[model samples]
Target: MITTHPFNDDKLREECGVFGVAGAIDAAAMVALGLHALQHRGQEAAGISSFDGTTFHDHKALGLVAGNFDSEEIMRLLKGEWAIGHVRYATTGETALRNVQPLYAELASGGFAIAHNGNISNAVKLRHDLVRSGSIFQSTSDTETIIHLVATSRYRTLLDKFIDALKQVEGAYSLICLTEMGMIACRDPLGIRPLVMGRIGPEDGGTVIFASETVALDIVGAEFVRSVEPGELVVVSGGEIRSHRPFQQKASRPCIFEHVYFSRPDSIVDGSSVYTVRKAIGGQLAIESPVDVDLVIPVPDSGTPAAIGYAQQSGLPFELGIIRSHYVGRTFIQPGDGVRHLGVKLKHNANRPLVTGKKLVLIDDSIVRGTTSLKIVQMMRDAGAAEVHMRIASPPTMHSCFYGVNTPERSKLLAAQKSIEEMRQFIQADSLAFVSINGLYRALGEASREEEAPRYCDACFTGDYPTPLTDLSEREQPNQLMLLAERVGG
Candidate 1:
């Protein structure tokens, strides 16, 4: 039977990707291309919603963008000059098609569709109150909570209604919405998630594109204008665009792991090139934990930049000791349980000749559950490596991410449960060291993580969450909120 690859479960999974284009000819086509570029952020499902003057069209499917949105039939069905798309990994909802987004609704105002990235920590509590007040929900996605809020809001204007909905929610969100008026895009006040605005032509008649990352804009030949400011909303209509800041501005705390793992290497987040920052992180890791090794080797694609930085800083040769198979798309048919046990090698395998008896420094982004790390160390030893010292580019991930990342519970986190030496023993590495939190801050060009107000969100490493976790606090009230969460896929 075909099953999704389980080897990638050891790392944090990004929640979703949002892409939209306004005032563009064949906007749906541009949105499809942009969604393809942001596919790494989400892979389980893809959807597109478009508005053509008087009518709105939508198409959603369970699979990759290439599998769903690449078809001429699907593209032709989504006919419009304004479009928004979403790729989802389902952090707050089930994997069923009913939960797939750019979720659309017919309201008193008109047809409204939304594509959302990030999570709402207070969704469960809000959902309970909404349900009690006669809000019938069709999907379990937290994004649907916003729609219900808009529908029941006392605000007069659609724009005011959107801002009203956002004010009631607590947590990270970057949203792209399609309304009869035009397209609206915004990031949460904390900027815990990412969104950027770009344009394809001259200011007057150009297509305005919004995406979760700059790489999405690049794919559609759009010139990046700027990141959507935290607490700011941008609206496009009739070939015109405007910005509004509805919430009070606070220090932005964009997710730091975006540079380490979530974003594509070519993308830029919060004015920093993801690839450049990753390399700097590797340099920091090397300085913090220098090792006597024959060569520096990256775990695979995600680790390559850091590995290069490590080699450059430590004055060692960088080698591709492990090769990853690009053919392993998302899922493969596994014959039986026994073969499943060896699935790790299907995606990655060591280059036997290069590391045959040589001591190596293995570079990786971070160790999550430690299962992948254990398998990789074992793979190196089996390939005749004399020694394997593992170096992590980021600090130990000791806390679960409650914003947008799909993380295991705190108990499952390797670093949260074990010390550095214990993790070294568990992974069977000769030595294991992670970049210090201060080192990570330095790599990002900060003096250090300020106790008063950090420039970036390092909650995964420091256990200092920027926002309140409402759902967790309501965990004891199973009959009221927690029970509702199970039914709503929170």
Candidate 2:
């Protein structure tokens, strides 16, 4: 049997999603629901670890949540009052059961399990150090690095050891941990990733919830509380929640792409509505680049919201020019060679009647490799469209993201090597325009981005990484290595 990934192949991929709850009667089930709500963030694998006051129970598998955890038998096995779960789309490690998280360990402090979202840039260096110091690693995941750090720390409390573990790492992380002590939720110093807190039940006695997005909270009937502050470590135990900032504070720079593509439309991230922000980005694109088109069409699901805003702002009719098939599986057995060439058409079909003889505007979140864009433009022409113009909601993605997102190398990025005109030619579109960097910031409610110190991580677009790329710096071209080495250390 053969398996194939879903149709759209030109989009950036998110790393993972995490959810944790403390004090819930059915903690594992609640975590399941939260993970389901965040399924879009990661589709490769799912796992949950629960602490039942006396012992830890866990189930991890390599597939969707519905297939793995929906059974009553599976839920029954994960009995506990506190739990943490993770849905993974691997960025730093291979897709295997061992790499699947809520990675658990037995430390001097008792059972510790953690589910993480985002990449640890210094993991390679740290792993090398730990291995050299006689620490044995159970999994290949960088998340396990923290576990080792905690196990070896001389600190008196588990919280202190966890804090010490975090202080030694660099890169983006929004983590939810389960321990005999309690539930610990924390974000990195720069807040490059996102973690939100919520509550359910009566005010006096409620279940504390932590998840990667507000949508997760909504799914579980939890009231959305404030985000876990940058550089803040939150410990929930004994019906009480406490916050601490162990690392030096700095300006928070959450990943801006969450607004562009990663998060669910209904999610509220970093205090902004993702749907509204995406719509605004489309509106901004329309303002900056207007073309005479008969209709505005989205590339389906991801582009729907932005396309609506573009249609509204441009005074053009909105149409479903392309219809997406929801039934396509992650892996399918191809019967013959002839059917393999119809890959894009298998997932998306042009609405011939609506697209015939129309000069259409196609709006998409971002262009990664340009292969999907090329195929879609050809599909529109095949459906008798007079012309197809492309409008991108976010600025061109020029640099690879080392902070969790899976992106092609800089040399492979479409925009990194080609000019705007070249990109239009490559995608075979009549015309193409991307939202300006400043316009994107404006849509996000900022006047303009501060070149000196950006409010968010736009490194993929501007090449201005907020944190040091430790792993990449050591392996980059020799000419550039010297400069980066000096900036980051020897």
Candidate 3:
């Protein structure tokens, strides 16, 4: 079986990251740097597509950005004034080279290439109709559906055809498309995903950038201008930027998970610092579920900021009871089952001196399968911990995400299948508590979740999906993997 990072298996995985720059010299190099910064969003594959006035050049490979694009030879092949790049984790298709993105196609008007950062919920349905009408797809990726839609649209102009194509699709998307004319960036009507605009130099003569996170902008020395408004399309043509509203306007509900886990801590999303929000979540968790302990320890990396807040708020001494090995790759060639069982240890190990005979509190962002948590708790006990209590920064995730997040089926989620006490027992922790839903909203600086209209997409916790699951509703028995596979093969 292909496994992800051993330590990250229990956390929700984001689909991808997108970066695009127009009107810049050596645009492909800048995109390479930006994608390197956004690599945490996806590590399985990386691709870059560039448009010099007439032709489009692209290079995609199945590996980390550094492994693929670090060579000057590869960079030389992708020369252009405008470029777009993508890092993918395969939300809708199999992990194949053909599915790697910046899916390109030749249209009646011109050549176009697009990099997307979300899932198309209605792709299966729309793909079936398109195949019936004789549209031959080159790749099994749902992103290819957009290209076909644009190719077959009756609209005259490329912009009109692009807008018409988007009008036919449903689900969350933050897209950056490269064309012979210019680059176009747009967010889904509901803004369930994130995209931001930035400038590298002055407005009169500068590079226009679009990225999934602001950290990408920072890496490329760009100043973030603003988030691309929900349902708004931004076009960068002839060294000028313009905005258009192509979809019917609706209340935007950006994905809350961006702040909880998907984004880099240093990145700013929707005018808020992800690190600050995570710390606030930790403080709120401490307020709602305080525990008396000798030391507060974080699970590492993702849980660090929240752990800091938890320690400060609870007035407990913070210590590194667990240390992570940064060298572990996502997948390793294990020789035997015995070696596979040691996966968690390969990524993280308990600090015996700090944990021995100490009552410790383990702070983590969220728990999904409970297997990792169970193993970590057992490791603590083996290290001679007197007691181990687990506190989660986010509310229990009881539902699967369909908006570009890779999640196990609802049945596989520990929170969905078990009660709080049942979870505590399963993980063998002395105590286990998750921050309440209202408390999470409070940490985000909201009074509470608006029962009728949520400010953010909290469907994984509350099961109140902001958009209709049309494809799921149509199926008699929905099989997520089967549906996605069929859409691809069809």
Total backbone collisions for each predicted model: 0, 0, 0
TM per candidate: 0.96, 0.96, 0.96
lDDT scores for all predictions?
0.91, 0.91, 0.91
lDDT, candidate 2, equals: 0.91
Clashing pairs in 3: none
**What stretches of model 2 exceed 4 Å from their correct place?**
334-338, 473-490
* C-alpha root-mean-square deviation, each candidate: 4.4, 2.3, 4.4
Candidate 1 Cα RMSD (Å) = 4.4
The candidate 2 region of ten consecutive residues with least summed lDDT is 474-483
| Candidate 3: segments with Cα more than 4 A from true spot | 1-5, 473-490
Residues 103-221, candidate 3, lDDT per residue (tens digit)? 98887698899999999988989999999999998788889989999999999999999999999999999999999889999999999999999997889888899999999999999
The residue pairs that clash in candidate 1, if any, are none
Question: For residues 88-192, could you state the per-residue lDDT of candidate 1 as single tens digits?
Answer: 997887898999999998888788899999999899999999999999999999999999999999998898999999999999999999999999999999999
